[model samples]
Structures are given as C-alpha cells and as structure tokens.
Target: MHRRHAPPPKLHPHPSPLSSPATHPVPYLHRLLSAAAPAVSPGPRFAVEDYLVDTCGLTRAQALKASTKLSHLKSPTNPDAVLAFLAGLGLSSADVAALVARDPKFLCAGVERTLSPILAGLTGLGLSRSEIARVASLAPRSFRSRSVVSGLEYYLPLFSSSESLLRGLKKYKYFLSSDPERVVKPNIELLRECGLGTSDIAKLCLAVPWLLSAKPERVQVMLACVERLGVPRRSGMFRHALKAVESLSEEKLAAKVEYLRNTFRWSDAEVGIALRKAPLMLTKSNQTLQSKSEFLISEMGLEPAYLAHCPVMLCLSLEGRVKPRCYVIKFLKANGLLDRHWTYGTIVRVSEMVFVETFICPHKEAAPNLAEDYDAACRGEMPTNFRFTWTKNRL
Candidate 1:
C-alpha cells in the first residue's frame, strides 16, 4: 500500500528474444562444430590429396598418409615451389618421386632455409650439377637430414678425387647419414692405432665403408681378432685379413672354423696355418669347402697339408677356374699332350691366357675338341659323362 513503490521497482528491459538462450539454444556440439569448421574445411580449389598425387607423384594411398602431416597446407604454393626447385636442379620426375616417397616432409621443408642451403653447399664443395643430381637421385635421404654438409666436408678430403667421392657416395649412401665425429672418426682412429696408415685407411673406406662406420669397440675387437689369427699388421696380407674379418660375423667365423676342422679332418694347428695363409678361406661357404676339397683331395690326390700351406687355392672358383683348368690338364696328360711335371698349384695359379695357350691352343691339332670342351666346362655345360684319368705316376 505504499503510495509510490518506486514505479513497481522499474524492471530493466528484457533481453531481446533474438538473444535469449531458451529461444535459440545452440547445442554444445553445434557450438564446437561452428568454432572448428574454419580449420577443418578445405580451401576453395585446393585439395592436398589431389595435389600430392597429381603434382608430387604420390599414389592416392601415399597422399592420404602424407596429408596427415601436411594438414596445415591450404594451397600448393610451397610444395609447388619445392618441386620447381628440384626440377630446376635437373631432377627428373622419378627422382622427385623417390625423394618424396622417402620423406614426405620434404615437401613441407622451407626451400630457402633447408633445401637451398644444402644445394648451394654441395655446389660449393665442387660437386657439378650432374653429380649433385646423381647424389640426390641415388640417396634422396641425404638432403633430408641436417648433417649432409658436415658429412660431405668430412668425407670429401678422404677420397683421392671427386670421382672416388662420387663412387663412394653412390656405393654407400649411408655415408651422408653416418655420424663422423661419433662413428667414423673414432673408428678411423682405432684403425690407425692398429697400424693402418692414412692411405690404407682410405683404401678400406673406399672398399668397405661399413667397416669404418661400425662401432668403435666392435672395430677394435675385429682388429684384435685379425691379429690373433697371425696376420701381422705390417704385412700386406693384414689389410686383406681385416677386410675378410670385417665381412664375417662371430657366428659365421665360428661356423667356418668348425667346418674346416670337422669336414677336412684338419687339426686346429692346420686350420690356423691355412687361415693365416689365406684368411678368405674362412669366408667360403660350406658347400664350396666340401666341393673344392673333394676335387683337390679325391680327384687330384692333393694332400690336405698342401691346401693348408696354400689356402688361396680354396678361394679360386671351382667351376670357372679350378675345374676347367684341371680338366684341361688331365686331358693333356692322358693324351701325352702336356708334361707330367706340371703341379696342381702351378696350373691353378697361372693366368687364364697362359692356361688357354699352354693347354688349349697347343693341343687343338691332336685333340680338336679340347678347346671346345674347355670352353664348355667354363660355361658350366660340361657333359655328365665327362671323366679324366688320374695319372698316379705324375704325383
């Protein structure tokens, strides 16, 4: 009943119906969709999947996988620039494809920041455009890592020439990815400590770069193993021994040693003697050991002691060099075309030209089929009925 109740407490104007939550309630999911729509939607006329397949040479599946990493790309401007830069460097479409396939993120790399500097650095290193292209094609991953320039800088001087460098790069692409300070340099130092000079080390790196890339401790162990086999570090055979040991695993070495001992009934001393003479004997397969030993022992009546003394005879090709030459010698002796004084070791160690002339050319008149048979045996087409009379008197 108050006379003037402040004009009924004067309510503020009601919120407009347009702005009322009850009148136009936006669901939570709808609000989220509205907020995120801009980001998830594709740009007009720019489809990343399509761009990858059509321009980058990726298949639909590859593009789909690559698009996950490149979702931020709304247009082809950056990738197009990357492709253009690669193409301008003489990379064929196949080369570009290989690069993208190996590392799809390459497409997203900054040209000026990442790729251009690498290329410029390569060129500055005296790599011609063609050689650079070859490197890129052969090892695209070489450019994807940050260590390429450092790798090249460390390795370039080790090679005698740019041709050698190119050969090493092509042969072992892992050179670009290898850690010189951690892996290469330490291993090289270990090799030097083992009496390898700079030139010898360079030869090893060219022939077997993986050996230098091995763990330092492992390389040291291998060096020790080689030395334990009686190969003197100062001897020329030392390098060959190192190469053969580097190619073998511990299990393989064990297996080969066991095979030589058990299969040939060789004592440990004899095996050691053989291995010291020709370390490559340990690298031969078990089948090769059996076949060659059988031919030398049973067919030619060569004593195992002889092989232990001259183990390099095992390294000769049984089919190509040993068997064919042996057949020629046997044929010549049976027909009295060759002197019986020629030894098995002498025949095997001779040059191919000498063997052909001494065994094949001289006897072609008396035995017209001798040269033909020798050639046939070399090609692995020897007749099943082929036999040679073993001359007991010659031995």
Candidate 2:
C-alpha cells in the first residue's frame, strides 16, 4: 500500500546523570554500602542518609526511612552503618534487633534433639570431641551452645552399645496403652504379620506423637486391640485397626459388632462371651457356625478383618427377644440383607442365619434416595435394631 508511513523514530532513552562510571551500577553501589557498614559498635561517625545515597545508590528519601526505622538498634547517630548491614541480609534493622533479642535456648534444644542420633552413630567411628563439635556446629542452626550438653549426654551412651535409635523409639510404643481409660491395645504380632516392621512402628509414633505420652498399659491395649477384635491371624488386622479408629464412632462400633453377630450366625451369649474376653483373645479365633444355628447369628463389617480378633461381639438373639414384625424388617434392611418378597413364613425357619446375614426393611429397597443409604446400612450406621428379619410361608 502507499509505502507504509515511515515508522516514528524511536526516542533514545536519555542517559541518566547518575549513569556515569561512578554511579553506573546501582546494585553494586548497594553492595559496596553493605560491605562498608561496620559491626554494631558504639560509634556515631556515619550519617545514614549521606552514606545510603553516596555509597549505596539509594534515594535520600529511602535512606531517611531506613535510618529512622533502624535508629533504635544501631547507633541512632550512625544508622547508615547498621542499616546497611541489615539490608545486606534483606532484613530491616528492626527485624535484626528483634532476632537478636529472641532467646536462642529453644532453638538450641531443637538442634540437639535432631543431632542426637547422628552424633551417637559417629562416635563409633572414633570421632574426637573437637571433631564432633565442629561437625555438629557445621551441621547448622543453633548447635553452637554448651547447654545442649545434656541432650548429647543422654543420647551419646547408646553409641557403640547394642541399643539403637530404633530401640529407643520402640520404647515409646510401650508407653501408649498404659492408661486405663484410653488404652488402645494394638496387636503388634498382627502388625508384624501384616508386614509392618520396627521402622513402621517408629513411623507410627512420629505420625501420632501423642502415642508417646500414652501410658504404657494403654499402649499395650492398643497394640493388642487387633487380636482382641478376633481377626484371623492371616489377615492384615493392624492396618484395619488403624482405619477402624478413623472410621468407627462409638455407636457405629457397637452397631458393627451387632452386624457381625448377625452375619456370622453367632448367638447373643456367644457374642457377649467373645467381647468379654481380653482384646488379644478376640483375635485368637474366627467366626464359627455354632451347633445351634437356629438360635444364633453373627455378621461383621465390610472391613471386619480387624474386628475378627476383637472381643466385642455384634450378635443378638431372637430366641427369647420379642419385637414387632416391622421392627425386624427394619433391622434386616438396615444391614442390607432384607428382601421384602420373603414373607414371615420364609424367614422364621432360618431366622438366626437370615437375621444375622441380612438387614431389615419394611419394603423393598427402602430409602433408595438416601444417597449412601445402602452403604451406611451395610456399615451398620444405625445405632440399634429393635427387631429381627422373619418370614412364615416358605418353611
């Protein structure tokens, strides 16, 4: 087209008056200012604003602001020097002073805690104290103190001895189940069977540090908990137990136990007997089809592998118990085994097994719109079931 109009001439950036060799690199001037700043000594020779602009390339206004903020920490009369030192660290003078005033003892304690294991491990290699101190100091933040002596003292003895950091961590586990009210009774042997090791146990403590504060007896209760749940020896009860604690509320736990009794055809007395035993004893056996299958029932959770070893039985008996037929249907549907088509005639014959294995419902697929309703029932979400599933015609 009509030869593109000549492009407007680019305006060359006017060279700054401060761009001469002496002032060319502003950042370099700041670096120079930083290097020239003296340590915190009682002297009032340097004026903050004059040095900031002349040496650090800062505007007079910025220099004034920095000086004012830093006046209390560095000598007020020589603020420029202290400001430069702090600016080098990308910190304000106020920040520097605050950091300086903070007690470092807590920091030292933390460092000692972290280094205790490493220092012990190195002692066996015949490292000298001076060498150790140097290495520990170089290891970083807050290790430069004499007070950490006790921390080191406590850990140093384990070096070269048969004991190890792992052993010490394990000692923490024994403390967890000591309290009577909160005892966990985890099954360590089951944990081992589940492929967990000493390292895993240590990791568990780290994940829940409060476990260390737990009484040893309470910890024992938790460790033996899987066994008490009556889970099979071959199952991964330990992991299941951990998940159980996460998912099961007290009401849910009881409901789940009841489900187990119904699903497995366990009698009320049988379920009660199992639960009454020590938690470890629960894991000693699996659900059994007892001789009186007509009178008893048992069921377990979807993840009942852990509960298999627990002593709490989920079973209830229909032999002497009386309830409305509607109640029985609700219970069966709640546990997910209810089938409305079956009349009272069909259910009563196998009442024990059917009631244990199935849930009750007054109608087919009751509460279908209740999202996760089916799952919640399967999980025994209800607190209690007042009746049992019954049918009359089929028998």
Candidate 3:
C-alpha cells in the first residue's frame, strides 16, 4: 500500500508551445500542422457496396448492381490486394475505376495465382508497365486469364509495338480473351497458309484483329471468300479484301455483291473488278454506295461501267474531295478559262497540293476569288459563284 501510494505524482505530458498541457499534448509544430490539416479518418467499415462505390469509383446505382455479384466477398482483403497490384502497374485511379466498372469480378481474382503471374510473364515478354496497364484496363477479364501471356507473346512481335496491340484491343475487346492455341494460333497459321507474310498478317491485325481470334473453320471460309474476290493473295489489296469480307457472312457478302451488281449496273465480272479495285466498297453501307453511285453516274455524267473500273473513286469522299473539286471545275468553266478537255479522274485523283497547283493556282489571273471560293466549298459551304449554272464543257 505504501509503495502504491504515490504513483509517480501522476506524470503529465509537457505542454506544447501551440497548446495547453491538457489531455495529450503533442509537439508545437506538429500540433499546429495537425490543426491546419484537414481531418482524415479510416473509411467507413468495409462494406463491399461502400468499397465499390467509394474506393472503386462506381456510381451508387452501379455499386448496388455490381455488389450482388460480389456477395461472397466478406472482406476487402482480396480487392485491396488486386488494387495494390494494379496501382503498382502504373494505372491511374481513374483507369482502375473504369476497369472495375467494366468487370467487377476482376477484383475477386487470385493475385498470386493469376495476376502476379500474368505480370511476370508479360514483363518477361519485354512489355513495360504502362503497356501492360493499357492491356489490363482494356481487357480486365483477359488480363486475369493465363492465355494472355501467350497471346501477347505472339502479338507483340507481330504488332511490333504495344501501341498497335492496344488499338486492336480497343476495337475488338476480345483478342486477349480468345483461346490462343485453338483460335488465334490456328487462324494466324491459316493466314500464313494463305501466303500472308508477317507484315501482311500484322496489317490485318490492325484492321480486324477479331479475325485472328475467330474460329479456324470460319476464318478458312472467310479467307476463301476473300480469295474469290479476285484480289490475288500476292497483291497489297489482299489484306484490304480480308478486312472487307471478315465482317460479312457468306449470305451477306452475296447479297452485297448482288446489290453492287444492281446498283452500279455491273455484270458478275464487273462486280469482281470493282471488289478487286476497292474491296472496302463492299463494307460501305447501302446508303453510302447508293449516294456515291447517284452522284458519279447522274450528276457527274460518268458511266456506271466507268465506276466499276475506277471503283477507287467511290472510296473518295463525295463531299470532301469530289464535290469541292467539281465546284472549282464548274467555276473555271463558267469563266471560259478551262477550254482544254478534262476528265473527272484528272480533276479528282491528284493530291490536294497537286490539285490546287494544277486547277486553282493556274487561274489566279482569271478569277481572283477561285482559291478562296474553293476553300469555302471544301468546308461544305456553297459560295455564290460556285453555284451558278454554266454550259457543260466537252470531255
């Protein structure tokens, strides 16, 4: 009792210069810093919904909907590990948010068994953390898959850079998820069998990466269809034809071919010629082809057969290059300056600099406003002189 009597005079903390010696005083500068700093506290006890909404950046409604799938998640331990790993990968908080929003189940993945291994394998493939982050953000489901490593292994060398691969992922969104052995590899081999070099296959990947990820059976059929379009496999246009036919089923391709035969007034042989010249025209919507046909055949006084032979003109912008140049020609004709014979190809096919130098610059003395009027026409406006009726010039 005597020893316990005086408990060391109930020692107190030294008073801070910034505050009174009451409760628990801290250092003067620390006290002032604390007083000035905004109060921060641990987040509200880790409800999955709360974490999804607050930490993962899902909206309240999205959190509510997505939380149901995560009902088995009792703690934030797994999600926390996943988030820490993603953060280490150089993904910004917003990128994590978007990736989670797109695939909430991504958080439930095993970090050691799935994510860490994927990171290590991709690192072995020489991809920097930023490139891996882009792939993860673009395809989270695939990012968690074991096959992703092999897919990137094959794709990185073919694509030559992570930038092109990311672009393909954005457009297809399923490249990494597709089975590398059964689907992607087989289809790529098929492309090789069809005589596509690494460069050609890489070019095809940029256009229709999904084609490589498609079933081998379907790819073979589509490749056959592309070959039948009369663009020889050796031609540079072969890859263009591959992209054109990749989206169309045999039925749709046939319908489009028949529609082309009817719209452009082409025979079977002419349809082949047009498709070979510009396979992209087959992918154009009916409305786009129809409008171009009407303009080239009716307004421009070109024959339908001529368009079949020069189908590249259909690929040109009717409003951008064709219409503006047509207006310039009409302006020259109205002023009687273009006395020489001129074809639409001569007027429309030259590069912009050449077109201006050849058509607009030469007539500077005749019409001072020709270049100015042409500039306005290129912007989709109709200058007054550009719209005037003029006698048609002989071709």
Query: For each candidate, what is the lDDT?
Result: 0.79, 0.41, 0.83
lDDT of 1 at 139: 72
Q: What is the TM-score of each candidate against the true structure?
A: 0.83, 0.24, 0.80
The TM-score, computed over Cα atoms with residue i paired to residue i, of candidate 3 is: 0.80
Candidate ordering by lDDT (highest first): 3, 1, 2
Candidates 1 and 2: which is better by TM-score?
1
Query: Candidate 1: deviation at residue 49, Å?
Result: 3.3
- 321-365 per-residue lDDT for model 3 (tens digits): 888887677667767778697777668888999989888787666
The most accurate candidate by TM-score is: 1
Superposition TM-score, candidate 1 onto the true structure: 0.83
| Full-model lDDT, candidate 3 | 0.83
Ranking by TM-score: 1, 3, 2
Mark the regions of model 2 whose C-alpha exceeds 4 Å error after superposition: 1-196, 232-235, 239-243, 246-252, 255-395
lDDT of 1 by residue, 176-258 (tens): 78788898899878877777787787787777777756788888888888887778776767777888888778787787788
lDDT, model 2, position 309:
34
